[model samples]
Structure formats: structure tokens, C-alpha cells
Target: MIEALIVGAGVSGLSCGIRLREAGIAAQIWARDMPARSTSSVAAAVWYPYKAYPEHLVIGWARTTYDELMVLRHDPASGIHVRNGHEIFPWQVDEPWWSGAVPSYRRITPAELPAGYRDGYVFEAPVIEMPIYLDYLRQRFEALGGTIEPRTLASLDQALGASDLVVHCSGLGARLLAADSTVFPIRGQIVRVTQVALDTFVLDDYGPSGMAYIVPRSSDCILGGTADEGMEDMAPDLSTAEAIQARCRALEPRLGAAVVLEHKVGLRPGRPTVRLEREQLAGGKLLIHNYGHGGAGVTLSWGCAADVARLIAQA
Candidate 1:
């Protein structure tokens, strides 16, 4: 089997490892901390195909990941669910954003909208509990005889010498590791409440300058948060947390009672466009660059992985 070394163990790294195994390639992921210990866990894992990606792949990637997770939903081992919900708001239904792709995706007739919502559409999409989902990917990787190495790499050259190929799934780490000044960090903050009710998801475009949303996971209610802002360090900012909660509480009542299980944060490795390029290194190392999904990492994970793996195969 062809052996590959994958750097950075986020969803991209994990998903890429899983796909490589399916293609009969042996893959190992090396990271300072495991995938779940960081950004992958902080996401309110919404699989929405939004403006975050190019039209050719954005919606299509979310659609493909949804289909794959559905087949596994029946298996108790698979920690995924088909979460049905709506993208809601008041005064913003003009030129509705979620009209075409999701099933039963029609606007609630005037009589159907809740009192507070001016109007909105109900649509069904898969919401993943990222904690379990991350673990599941790790299991699938090992089941296929893949390896995961957990360590803080001081240099990319360390892995460069031993492997036939190196995939940088390092997320924000690439800013230094690959000398990629293009990859800066978008800070996202979220509150996981030990509180939840209701079976679906809620997205309120009302960002206080507000793009607020609430996603339910099995253990904790994942409520969030967003940004169009970039910060250099990967630290959670308090004012940002307050702003997200204030918006979310105004939108959803249950989460309003939120007893914080954890206030989590992550630096989403962001670029104007996601880079899925391949490079031959200074010493002739084969590198597949697959970072920069911004906030849509889970939504685009597997599909992006397929593209990354295809490029690596050709390289």
C-alpha cells in the first residue's frame, strides 16, 4: 500500500485520512493535539452550503457529505443525525437565501410563520455532533489500518524526509509551517450549554452586525457565533463571546437559559479562497495543501478531501 503522512489532525486531516484508506492507501496523521481538541470541536457543525466557497464546490460538497452521513446514521456506531430546521429571520425574507437546494425547501406560507419571524423557510439538512463525528472518523481510519501520531512538530522538514507525500491539514499552523502569509486566522467563539430542547437547528441572519445561529448536539447545545474578522492569535475573546450570546439569546429561548458547559474558541484558517494546491518542495517533497475552509470545514470536509486526494494522486 502507498503510505502517506498527513499533517494537522483537524476534520480535513481526518476526512482525508478516511478517504485515503478507502482508496487502499495507508495514511497516518501527525498533530500536536488530536483533532477534537481544537477547532473541529468548537464548531456548531452546520452543514449549510453558504457563500463561503466557490459555486462549483460549495453546495455540492455539503450535499455529498450529507449523503454519506445518511447511510451511516442507522448504525449506532455512527454518530450522525438528519436534523431538520429552518433558516429564520424577520424583515429579511426578501430574496430568501435558502430557497433552492434543501428538500421541502419552501417558504412557510404567511399563515405558517411564528409570530416573531417575519417569514422563513423550513428545510431539512444534516447537523453533525462534531465530537462524536470526529471520533467516528478516527475509528474508520484505524479500522482501515491507518495510524495517528500525536506530537508537536517543530518543523515540516521532520516529516518531509520520511514520507513520499505530505498533506498540510494544519489549519492555522500553516501560517508558519508553510510560510503561508495568505493563511491568517478568523476567530470564532461558541458556547456549549448543558442545556437544550427542540430537535432542530436555528439560524438567524440577524448578526448584530449579526450572523447568529444555534445548533443542537447530543451532549451540549452548540450555540454560536461567527465572524468576518481575523485575529493573529488563537485566543477566545470575551467581548466576542458576549456578542454572540446576546444575539443567540434574542433568537432562541432555550439557549437563553444557557448554563455554559464550555466557552470554546478556534482560529479558522482562512483565505479569500480555500487553497487545494499541490507543490514540490525545496528538496523535492510532494505536498498537498488543503487548509482554509474558514467556517465551513465540517460542511465541506469529505468533498474537499476527495479533491485533495485526487490532486495528491496526480502529483
Candidate 2:
């Protein structure tokens, strides 16, 4: 029997384990921390690709993930909801390269444009409540005869002794494990506040103040964030949190009175492009590398996992 070891417990790693198990491979996940503590948990996690590149490939993965997410949205336990939102821009531009990925997408009307924004587009995409979604994934993976062990690897080579194959879903940890210099951190911070009356997500990437977005969940809403590239600080900066609130409040003043809940910071694994290729290890075992989705880790999760399964099958 073929056995596999996935090296991270984040959305990417869990999704990979589920796919591999579904393919009848004996798969287990090994992580340094629990899924809830992963950087994935800190994401606004909307099913839209942000800061990931190489148009053609990204769109295919994003589109596949979008279809899957829409299906998951119907299952309340999945913690995915198809939410309507607008992506406002400071100036008019060409239709987004990945616009076709979403089920519904259109230009915003003059009245719909927010104050000070030149143009915008409205679309309905899955907004994942990370905590609930991660828990759902963990449960689903375990139910599929998958196991998760909390073990940190000093190097990628360490997993070779335990399994016939290794799937690297280590996110930023890949920088050290894979010795990939292109992998770096895009530090992001978000503020979770008590729920307001807002039902829609607002993403204003070109706001004068910086990139700001509001993602409303059932119990609370996530307001974010900063995209400080190469920043390794995991601790939340109070000033950045306040600035995020100010920007989000500018989008919807109703957020003014929302009580502060918590702040989170995560290092998004920023890379020029995602790496999802296979390699042969020194000891005759197989290794599939699937890291560097950046902010699209959740957006591209399922598609990447499916691809990894395909690669393994062909091997």
C-alpha cells in the first residue's frame, strides 16, 4: 500500500490529505501546530485570488476551487457562504484576468461606487469563516481514515523515513525546508469585531489608506489588513489594527460601534507563482511540493490538492 505524509496542517495540507485518502492512498498529516493556529486561520479567506500570479494556471485552479466552494456553501457545516461583495478600484481598468472564475461578476454602477473610488465590480464568492472551516476540514479528514500527528520536521528529508511519499504543504516553512529563496512572507493583520448589520464583503485594494476589506461572518466580522512584504513579525501591531478599523469604517460607518474582539497576524507565503511539482528524493521516495499560494491558499486549496493527487497517480 502506498503511504503519504503531508507536512502541514493548514488548509492546503488538510485538503491534500483528504484528496489523497479519497484516492485510496494511506495518508496522514504531520504539522508543527494545530490547524487553528496555522496562518490559514488568520486569513479573510474569501474565494478570490489575491497576489497570486501567472494568469492562465491561476484561473483554472481558482475556477475549480470556486465551483467546489459553491458546493460546500450549501452544507452549513462546511462554513462556506456565497456572499456578495464589491472589489473597488481607484481607477478604471480592464476586466480582471480571473473575472471568469466567479459565478456572478459585473461592473458596479455609478451609485454603487463608494466615495473616492473610480470604479468597481460586484461578485458573489464564497466567504469562508476560517475557524469553522478549518475545524470542518479537520473532522472531514479524520473521518476519511486520515490521521494528523503534531510533529515538527527539522528538514524535509526527515519525512522520507516514515512514508513512501511526502507532500510538502508547509507554507512559509517551505522557505527553510525546500531551500526555495523565492518564498517570502507577506505579513497580514486583521481585526475581528462583533458582528454588525453588514451582509456584504467589501474589498478596496486601492484605497488611499491602504488595502482594506470587510468580511462578515455569522457571529463576527473580519476587518483587514496590511500587505507588508518580507515582514516576519507574527505579533499583532496595535497601530496597524487601528488603521485597519479606520479604513474599514470608512467603507461602512456602521462598523463604528462594533466591539473589538481580537487581532491576528499571519505571514502569507508570497511567491512569484505557486510551486506544485514533483521531485524524486535521494532515498528513492517521491516528494510533491505544493506551497506558495499566498493569499489564495484557501482560494486554490482544492484544485491544488486534486492536482497533487494526479501527480502521485501518474508517478
Clash pairs of candidate 2?
none
Candidate achieving the largest lDDT: 2
- 1-315, model 2: which lDDT tens digit per residue? 337999999999999999988899889999998999999999887988998877788898899899998888888899888789999998987898889988699998879877888888999999999999999999999999998889988888788778879999999999888999999999999999999888999998889989999999888999999999999998999998999999999999999999999999999999999999999767678999999998999999999998999999998
lDDT of 1 by residue, 229-279 (tens): 566555667788787777777766666766877777777777677777898
Whole-model alpha-carbon lDDT for candidate 1: 0.74
The TM-score leader among the candidates is: 2
Each prediction's TM-score versus the true structure: 0.87, 0.98
Least lDDT summed over 10 consecutive residues: which range in candidate 1? Answer: 95-104
- Report clashes for each candidate as comma-separated counts: 3, 0
Once fitted onto the true fold, the runs of candidate 1 whose alpha carbons sit more than 4 angstroms away are 90-101, 110-119, 232-243, 256-258, 281-284
